[model samples]
Target: MTVGFVGAGRIGEPMVERLLAAGHQVHVYARRADVLERLVAAGAKPVDEVRELATCDVVVSCLYSDAQVLEVLPAIVAELDGLLISHTTGRPGTLQRLGHAAIVEAPFSGTADAVRAGRLTVYLAGEPEQVATARWIISSYAGPVVATGGRGTAMRVKLINNLLLAAITQATLRGLAAGRAMGIDESVLLEALAVSSGGSTAARQMDARGGSENYLAAITPFLRKDLVACRDAAAEVGVDLSDLLAAAYDGPMNLGV
Candidate 1:
């Protein structure tokens, strides 16, 4: 398949490399010349303009934020004759601004390392045919392509996923702190939880990163971005997220709630 891609950053660049290695003809674009050159060196064709993606079989935008997606994606869909798959995790309304192109809203879960390991999980939302076509292209890097009905639903699911993860992370951090107060080692507390019923991916991640401090430092920026997006999205729909948001903000991580 001939694929057009944008936003070759930490999360996106790995997907481009996987697509190229899967033998797809990938035309990549980035605002930065350095990013363009890096993707080009990874066997992707560099495109100067986003509109040049119109001629490809599929166009995928994995930009950093909803702001960037809003700024960049309308150009490709304006002339695009093929499916457009968005992997950015943000507001559902963000996708609505891209016009009536055949679009699959696929906000994925998992990290850049997950992409490199072919273990990324994608929440898919679109018309059936568009989603069916998107699964093939997305499978090059993603493990599971979970369908979530019509457009916008995938982002909603992703926001909930991030919000819940944040809550779990906060709860785990608080529990570990309590354990410390009780004279238990924080690291040992994490290790015990990894095998206990209280175990969570968030707790395991803290253990993986060596401790709470390093884990908090590493994920703070991305977690803050996702949590704020979740809060904003919930507010737009008039959904009360106070209970969840309170737990998320109650931790020591300082995610800028």
Candidate 2:
């Protein structure tokens, strides 16, 4: 299959590499010349513009946010002949607003490490035939291509997933800080938590990173963005997220330990 890729950042670059490895003819475009050049060196054809990708069988966008996706949608919709698989973790109504039936909502979970290791899980929402049409391309670099019925469902799931991620990580950091103040060694506290009912993926990640400080610093901005998006989504549906927002926001800001 001829696949066009937009945004060759960390996650996008590895996906393009995997597509090339799977024998797909991959065409790529990115504002970063260095990023695009790296993929071009690995067998992807570099396009001068996003619309140049219109000739491909599928166009996969791994951009950062809804704004970036919207910025490129006009050119893609006007010129593309095949499916548009968006991996952006944006608002629920974004897929419908794209106004293209061929567009599939395919927000994913996992980090760039998972992408390179082929362990990323994709949440797919579209018509059955549309999901099937893009499954092979998405599955080339992702695991467990989960179908969630119709458009917007996948983004809803992604937002919920991110909310839990933020909540759990913040809770883990607080637990570690409290334990340390009570005179327990950080490593011992983490090990005990690992086997206790309090164990979580977020705790394990913090342990793996040696401590919470650096990990928290590195992820705070990105996690804050997702949390804000979740808050907005919750507001649209009349759901109150005051407590969740307080925990997720205040903990990071007050991290003096």
Candidate 3:
């Protein structure tokens, strides 16, 4: 399928590469001209204007936030009768506001390398037909496409998943710090937890770090926003989210500007 992408940042760039590698014609738009060089060299057509992408079969956005998505909608609304799948992790509500377009929320799990290796897990939410098309496009590059629900539902699942991840990641970090302070081998404790009741997706991420930036970049404004969204979503449903909020703000300083 012909695919268009907006916001060719870290996540967006990798996604474009994978889509292009999968034999799909990709058109990309980014604010910075320099970022498009690799995509251009890799056979992607660089779209100078964002509205140009409206002509594609599907346009996936991995933008920084909900407001950014809103800002781009007017430019392409007339051109986007086709599906708009949002690869951005935390902006389901923003997608819902685009009533003129058939919006799909698809948040991916795992990194760019995993995506290149066809190992990323993508959760999709949208209209049934749009979702089917999205699955076809996503499967061309990802490991599995999980259809959680329609439109905002998929993003809600993503928000919930990230909430759990944030809490678990923070707990794991504090555990590691405590273990280190007490001189208990952090590696041993991690291994023990891996086989114990506390073992979880968060522990697995800790194990995956292997002393890399993967874990270090865990605490960021981006993550905090997602977790807070999860809290708000839960509150809307009458569920208390104090614990999650506490976990989110516990290491606020760790999330540097």
Candidate 2 per-residue lDDT over residues 1-257, each given as its tens digit: 89999977878999999899989999998889888878889999998988999889899999888788888876887877799999988788766777777988898887788888888899998888889987888777899789988887888888888777777877887888898899998888877776788978777766766767666766666666677678888999999988867766666444221
For model 2, give the 10-residue run with minimal summed lDDT: 248-257
Model 3 C-alpha lDDT per residue in residues 120-238, reported as the tens digit of each score: 89998877888888888877667778999877788788887777776666777777778889997777777777778977766665566652136656535667677767766777778
The order by descending lDDT is 1, 2, 3
Off by over 4 Å in 2: 191-196, 253-257
Please give each candidate's TM-score.
Answer: 0.92, 0.91, 0.87
Q: Please write out the lDDT profile of model 1 over residues 157-207, one tens digit for every residue.
A: 988888888889888988998999999999899999888899898888889
TM-score of 1: 0.92
Give the TM-score (vs. native) of candidate 2: 0.91
lDDT of 3 at 147: 93
Candidate 3 colliding pairs: 126-151
What C-alpha root-mean-square deviation, in Å, does candidate 2 show against the real structure? 2.6
Candidate 2 local distance difference test against the native: 0.82
Q: What ranking emerges by TM-score with the best candidate at the front?
A: 1, 2, 3
